[model samples]
Target: MSEQLPAPDPARFPALDADPSWVLSVPEGTLIARIFRAGGTHPVAWHEFRTFGPLDGRFDPHPLPVGEHEGAGVLYGVLERGRGGGVADGGALGGAFAAALLEVFQAQRMIRLRDGSPTLAAFEVTRPLRLLDLSDSDWIAVAGGNSAISSGDRERSRVWARAIAQRYPELDGVVSASSLVPDARVVALWAGAADALPRYPAALLPLGRDELIGVIDRIADRYGYLVL
Candidate 1:
């Protein structure tokens, strides 16, 4: 039988009453990379604000409240803060792309990229965004939480996210180091930051597109993940 991982200390979870101010600024023109289903709730240029869920994402605010918190959408992306440029720059392999890919397909050792019309998109943040920066160890401590918030039980983590949303509703969303790729920062934007998305993506293409085939291959090869 698979071992049941021990739950993180409940005392270390973000306190419902703790006031935290560890926000990070994602500046205008910053590149955000994502891999999304073209036909899903989050199509290109879409921020999923309309639907709150009982889903399994660590930070998806469940039972999203009405009143002030209503229509508080969320967008997930990897910040293209890596050196040597991004995917739009000469198709160079970037940490953001690799991180995004791993986030979606890590459950399977072999990633079947063709199954979902998985599309890769690059968005430029149009304005400054303030996000709860949980990636920092000190910031996590300030919230009375630990690194487990970023890499722990999804159900329990969502409980913490709900607390954050209730305590700091003005926050755009949360930012954390990718659980799969610690060096690559990931973002989840709430509070309807759709204006942050330009009318058109900076770059958009399906993973199966001819130009992206090599990029996907390189990422899979570099990470020792099988691509089919």
Candidate 2:
């Protein structure tokens, strides 16, 4: 179970309103494929994928086998118009984020997103990912700041989050405390877990394909949300 915290207050997050309104789940394989394909061309994204850690705000690239990031989920996040630079909706972005079910089969992989210059860098979590998701919910607000969102007691949050997710898969990505952005509240799980994880065992994510689909379906029924 997670530690008790104050109930969420949406009022504190006025800034987030302009942030990403919805999240599109990308499967682990997709990200691995992206990393693999981009390794030659986009070495920056690939290296960032290899040694990106959010526990502390720093880029200490470490080399490891590609299998290390096996269970990681590559999130092709969605952003709508009129929010945070009015990033447009659909197009390459839409096609990139529509794989909630494929993401479930992700084994021992996890990814962390960082707002970098002209692009977002995907950092690989060393810990075995227990759960992860994309959402506008304010359940996991930890502190306010650009770096605070990514480096606070993130490991603690991940452990607690994973336990909760195991019981309620839909809640897996609902409430993560780790932050790699200047300001972020939602969570994404298991696309880089294997690399940093001590074991090579099959990825044991909080939710399977069916459970993730349910969460996706529920969110889809709501307003201001979309899978792609």
Candidate 3:
């Protein structure tokens, strides 16, 4: 039987209160994963895992093959307590978990989200994603999709755009998955366009779907804290 690993701690990591966060610069056909850790502080971490050509009905629920452009994948990790910490030997536990996950990706031939959405096949892991400190209102502005409450209309867009600006006041503009504005500090994830929305001035992130997942696991292993 496989050994059970301890869960993450909560006191160290906190939960994300903001709804509708945005991930910008995702390459076309890339998969994004968002893992939400229950009962923890700073429970949110974004990872850009792998890139794949396309997905082939291996994973279920939201299975969609990669488009013409190379696709990328992302994952979110939330740390909760009951997990181990302060381990010796350079924390092999986390490294082992990451390696095992990679093996699974190769065997399954794809990565699936908690909702069972297909994201990536196989790729590499990138740098760790750190969420900047921003108010809940500002988070909603950048992360939240165009909704009845925060529509993408001229007025609403301006409102949302303003929120983003406030958070990263220093930024020239905001970029979202689909839209981009020069001198802005927000971007959205646009899978169809295979390109960043025009107007925003931030670096575009081109990655594979699987690469996203790898990053999520790493965060969960490294900084994830615990309680009790």
Per-model TM against the reference: 0.81, 0.27, 0.20
Local error of candidate 1 at 140, Å? 1.7
What residue runs in model 2 are displaced by over 4 Å at the alpha carbon?
1-37, 40-151, 175-186, 189-228
Predicted structure with the largest lDDT when compared to the true one: 1
Native RMSD of candidate 2 (Å) = 16.3
lDDT scores in order:
0.70, 0.29, 0.28
Q: Is candidate 2 or candidate 3 better by TM-score?
A: 2
The better-scoring model by lDDT among 1 and 3 is 1
Model 1 lDDT tens row, 132-223: 88876366665456777788767777777776766667767888988888988888876557777777877777877776677778778888
Number of clashes recorded per candidate: 1, 31, 66
What 10-residue stretch in candidate 3 is worst by lDDT? 177-186
Which window of 10 residues has the lowest lDDT sum in candidate 2? 78-87
Residue 152 CA error for candidate 2 (Å)? Answer: 2.4
Please give the distance, in angstroms, between residue 223's alpha carbon in candidate 1 and its true position after superposition: 2.0
Model 3 local distance difference test score: 0.28
Q: lDDT by residue for model 2 over 37-113, one digit each (tens)? A: 22234344332333233222111111223234323232322111111211023223222222222222122222211
Off by over 4 Å in 3: 1-48, 53-65, 80-128, 132-137, 142-228
